[model samples]
Target chain A: MDEMDNQFVTSLKENYQIVFQEIGLLEQAFTHSSYVNEHRNMALSDNERLEFLGDAVLELLVSQYLYRKFPEIPEGKLTKLRASMVREDSLAEFARECGFDQYIRLGKGEENSGGRQRNSLLCDLFESFLGALYLDQELEAVNQFLKKVVFPKVDAGAFSHEMDHKTKLQEVLQRAGDVFIDYRLTNEEGPAHERVFWTEVYCDGQLIGRGQGKSKKAAEQDAAANALRQLNE
Target chain B: MDEMDNQFVTSLKENYQIVFQEIGLLEQAFTHSSYVNEHRNMALSDNERLEFLGDAVLELLVSQYLYRKFPEIPEGKLTKLRASMVREDSLAEFARECGFDQYIRLGKGEENSGGRQRNSLLCDLFESFLGALYLDQELEAVNQFLKKVVFPKVDAGAFSHEMDHKTKLQEVLQRAGDVFIDYRLTNEEGPAHERVFWTEVYCDGQLIGRGQGKSKKAAEQDAAANALRQLNE
Candidate 1:
């Protein structure tokens, strides 16, 4: 390994107690596509594939964790909680906490444009790193790694603010003697990859608030949040 | 166990070579929420939570399978392949083949409404069953069960028809010369849960085809498919 690669490996060992049996996979995880494009002769693979696998890995682990931790939380709430935990900002925060910003390799243009500090890049780096860890050491080791870097934040209730807004709206409305509440999807628009969904919340069949988001559940939550805001005002 | 429950357990063992150490979980897996609502005095839990867990479990397993099976396939193609494998229609078909339809219990209203043969209910039943198996025997057992009931269909290439239409269309368009092909999201509409997306495919800045679907990827695929059809004619 080169001096930088050696330093990267040593840093992981010294800082996080992580050792990769397949050091190449570890290196590949940090190698962004832009970097590979700049060095085509080196024939380096990018982290996109690893990011894909890691996304699924993170999802399953987070789902299992939430399922066990909050047995009383229904599926809808669990879904929301899990989303809050793994959203781009949260994953980027986790990546920053691990000091991944120092190790992620980028192309000259990306480096000049401040790609390392970007949340999307940092989130992808964290996932790709986990994907490499899973490939190198399998699921249990990745689980152990997450226990150190990811789960503690969840345990500390860092994401509790993202609790079920729909349930909260229902509770707020029901304070007036079992008031009927409903949420309906009003419309959806945009391209296939970036679809926007609009939803409206109603009290006793009267529309109280309308909001929009990328998914149905998110739209419902947005509508509920708007309803809550209106009531508070 | 009641007589019907015993018969259900026996059928599972005899037909699928499966056994559950925790019979209550097995029973709960087959119990619909409607049935639980009707049997409120019994305090029996429904399968919603199990279905949630199972959905994640299925996603991971299918993702892992696809990742390994198609190491050369890009992440986007793998994602499309995984979607095809675990989609509602596919899951429902797997449930029917496994004879899960005979075991699922519903409330009188649902039973009268033909819930026993519903694609959605059957899909949820399959997921809940997998969830119960994962909880009872853990991931390996669920993997083994899918090997028998689900993975074989994938191995047989039953879902290859849902292959990347965008890629196929690109190949077709590229045959004449270096042609610029573009896909744009034209519009989106419908409710949040069932949001519809519309996409237009163009060649050399001229609109060739337009199509719609519930997801961005699906819409793009629909557009590509439509474009391909137009080219063929």
Candidate 2:
């Protein structure tokens, strides 16, 4: 490796505490599909594969951290918390914070279009980075890296950053002394084993929003979520 | 504790190496919602709360374990695998295997209906079990228990299974020397940032199944899943 490349590797190690046995894994994590399409036969794969693996690992680590930190919260609350934390926007923010944009190799057109700063791209790269970390070092190393970096945010309630619409709506209704908010199942279909239900949420006899899910309970939750969104709007 | 209860606790500790610090926690884990409903003034909480916490803990633990074990698999694949391993069916099976069915306190009606063997009920109880463990000991202890018991089936590749209908349809068509398989994007809606897609999958020029999802990719997967089901039928 040249002096500049050596500095890049050293800097990454210093920042992430990850030593890339196959630097190609790291490179692959940063190489977007646009970059690969532009350079046909360049003998480099896109980061999609790595991103796919990293997404799971990141989710697992984050979920585990939350469960350990909060013993009092229920599953529904935990699911919502985890969803907020691992959502695309949060992943993108983490990617930008890690300074992955500069290292990401994108096609000229994508670069021109500011693809490096795109939330979707950043999220993909973040996942790809996890994939690379898992392959290059192993689970322990990946766990260590996440614990040092990601776990702190989870501990500080970084994932539950926003008050969900449902909670907000409930507060609004309760404060108004209205308890007429009801969610009713409108329709259902599919086999008994995997039925899907459509639900509509109403407040004070006024319809607000509709939602669908694999179960009546899930559909009701979705309806509540939609109502929350409408209230926010 | 009564003689039967003491014996049950003793047997659990002797056989499973699990010593519950708060016996009430373990008792609560086995207390079904039916029981709570029937005996409204029992001053005992239902297992729903525990199930919720346990679900998160299980997912996190499974994700971490899988990441360490199969460092090569991508996140999407790993997520699917983890989902399969930790789904209601698997957890219910684990509950039954652990003799949880015998101890679960159910209502008379539920007991008559053989709720002990019901996957949904079993799964909920299993989550409660995890919740009890988490509250009684710690996250590490719960992880250790899971690793020794439930996680092994997954690790042993007992439930490592896959089926792709899109691929199957394509294969059947190719083998039959026909080009009758088609997938069409029927509708797209929602915000541009979080657009959802609807798709229809056809085989031999016949509309076989339909699906909807958050993205074209997910819609395609749903379509494929539906198509596979139709083929199986």
Best candidate per DockQ, number?
1
For this target, which candidate reaches the highest TM-score against the unseen true structure?
Answer: 1
Predictions in order: lDDT: 0.86, 0.76
lDDT of 2 by residue, B83-194 (tens): 8888889889888887888888899999999998899999999888987897788667888888778777754446545324454445434543556667899999989999
Residues B115-233, model 1: lDDT tens digits: 99999999999999998998898888888888888887866548757667786676566646678888899899989999999999999999988989999889989999898888889
**Residue pair clashes in candidate 2:** A51-A128, A52-B75, A53-B74, A53-B75
- Give the winner by lDDT: 1
User: Candidate 1 lDDT (Cα, whole model)?
Assistant: 0.86
How does model 2 score by TM-score? 0.54
For each candidate, the DockQ is 0.49, 0.17
Q: What is candidate 1's fraction of native contacts?
A: 0.63
lDDT digits (tens) for residues A99-203 of candidate 1? 888888899999999999999999999998988898888888888888888888866547757667776666556545667778888899999899999999889
Docking quality band of candidate 2, CAPRI definitions: incorrect
